[model samples]
Target: MSDLLARHRAVMPNWLALYYQDPIEIVSGKGNRVVDAAGKSYLDFFAGILTNMIGYDVAEVREAVERQLATGVVHTSTVYLLRGQIELAEKIARLSGIPDAKVFFTNSGTEANETALLLATYARKSDQVLAMRQSYHGRSFGAISVTSNRSWKNNSLSPLNVHFLHGADRHLTQFKGLSDAGYIAACVDDLRHVLATAVAGDVAALIAEPIQGVGGFTMAPDGLFAAYQEVLAAEGILFISDEVQTGWGRTGSAFFGIQNHGVTPDMMTFAKGLGNGFAVGGVVARGDLMDAPHAVGLATFGGNPIAMAAANATLDFVLSHDLQANAARTGAIILDGLRAAAPRFPIVGDVRGKGLMFAIELVDPETGAPAPALAARYMEETRSLGLLAGKGGLYGHAMRMAPPLTLTEDEAREGLAILVTALENIS
Candidate 1:
């Protein structure tokens, strides 16, 4: 092991996962690429697990952060009035689409999800909830309780009695044979059955990811959540969209990933892409539900000045540049190319994506089972050839790719070529 990596292993927890067999020490980044400690520059397709939304070394965000730091008041906490916080709240609330929406800032997606669950259960007065299989919300105590995927969950004991619903995984699920309409009906039926038989009283909410990010970019039919929201509305159970990965036009189809489902959720939690590279996350909900809690809640570092400044600059850059449109147009090129080339790559089982978020599932040629080893090999090969990709899935066999929304057509083509070459070598 390298000296730094050895020191990291000595100090860090064993549970903290690292990518690649021998991890690359990233030193600096610019535009859509990053350079390692060894001076090897590479195209970053995954964008630091989709957090670096606009790309690296963005002058807009960097300058905003520098300007804020120059003032020297970095940590006033939530007790004081922070202008950056208020502006960001207003912007997010306006874009949230919920009528009379309010915002609560948190330090990360896990905290955002925890806040959503707190509001949900407090308003409904229930400790029960519904979640989808293969869905990954966050890593908080409450967030993990609602998360159904074993791959993402480390603890089985949960405070809330979470009812896991079947619907999300399309490639290897039992309902894989069903068409879109049939799949939706089946999943909705499962939701109904869970509500009727499993629970005794009210369910606080049904929290879900539009596209299960850490579960390997798996998603249900476009309208599956819309159908679930209908059933949930009847019983007054809230629907929370965990848009940490799918929000902020990352999906290419809409600003929020849930918009494609044709329904408005009662609450939405977001984090990953909003701050670009800085740490920012929050929950947006209707005013009434947001006001349900009588007790005071405080996130000590939730809306810190630096994070807010970074988020504001990133949001401004994204909107002013029309990055959403670019994501659609550029992402289409990558997805279409991958699908067309799939015919020649036999070990590749699937090529799926929406907007900039996409995945390629690796499987054994003979058995068609998940080949996580092959996926790891592919990542190493790609890294060796000046590209960086990410890995996830229920079985750790899916190569997750979420380049910056600001990726140029040329960048997309270059990254796509590197990916194809990697796949070819692996196959």
Candidate 2:
């Protein structure tokens, strides 16, 4: 262990060391399982934050990548005719069923989000960005400026025009003045107020994760987004959905997270699950929006050959194998089991989210406050028992479960059993 640590410290950059990682050294992955250097296998319930939609070490993707490698070099400028990029763009467009839509690929979630912001700003010709409080939208400087995480900004960004709003705060807040319906109504009304009072040419776009991925997997109240869409459309504000975490069948649906809300965004960003663990991200814009002049937004790695091949394979696997429907089916069982388990545990406050992208929020039974410490402890205990879990929510009290869509029924049940054991031990 000392020798390995020495080797890592000697070769790796210190900036990466700033982040916390599990002590175990992962060597490889196969399907829904990953093996450490010591060869211990654990059910990957978190799926690398829900990026491995089709599971790890998928044969089709490996074969596709190998074929691409055999043909020629991986990276090439898209200024020329590129078969991989053209094929992926066509596949994504067909999967989305959108007309004359254009795709802009990038290297990661933040870059994809940054691209979307640029496109929206270019289209609307404004600076202000509206986002939901507690939402996670990547860490790019521009993306972080629009994101509501204060700690991430670190006061480095100047004059950020991010306006934060409550997402389902009507249900969470204890104020007696507003009913639940009225609370949701007020949230929408607040957006309307922002649009009305904010000076013209101030707000560029209203961006949100339709499912609020890291923000406790919170869903907007029914009809909330439809109502919000009306306000944004009337204000000439472009709607941007950051689906970097929720897109590509992880949410048990097709297309964007906004589809769940029954509204279409002017532009959408995607990263996780697009390449099934490969480094690929992209932005899909509406036809009219994409018609905006080029040269304003382009990436060297965007729509490159290797990344595009992986994405093409991932999309083929997802569609042909019905991974989205599988997620929906398996997710229902997990949600039911969790809801039943919640009643038995005093700390389990709520179980919510769409499909595999769900969470079990923990709270102190005595005070009804978020039990973040307890949740962290529970994660450690679960990992010790050979299950990998994730944390979410604003305060990080939510136990997030976003296993690979390829997870079998037995594997899911085993993971849930591990969770139940952890909850029992914590209690």
* Top of the candidates by TM-score: 1
Q: Hey, what RMSD does candidate 2 come out at? A: 2.4
lDDT of 2 by residue, 130-220 (tens): 8887777877678777666553554556334677777644445553367557766778878877767764665778888887766778777
Candidate 1 local Cα displacement, residue 104, angstroms: 0.5
Top candidate when judged by lDDT against the true structure: 1
The per-residue C-alpha lDDT of model 2 at residue 169 equals 46
Q: What is candidate 1's lDDT per residue for 313-424, written digit by digit as tens?
A: 9999989998999999899989999998988987998999898999999999998899999998998999999998999889999999999999999988998898899888
What are the models' TM-scores?
Answer: 0.98, 0.93
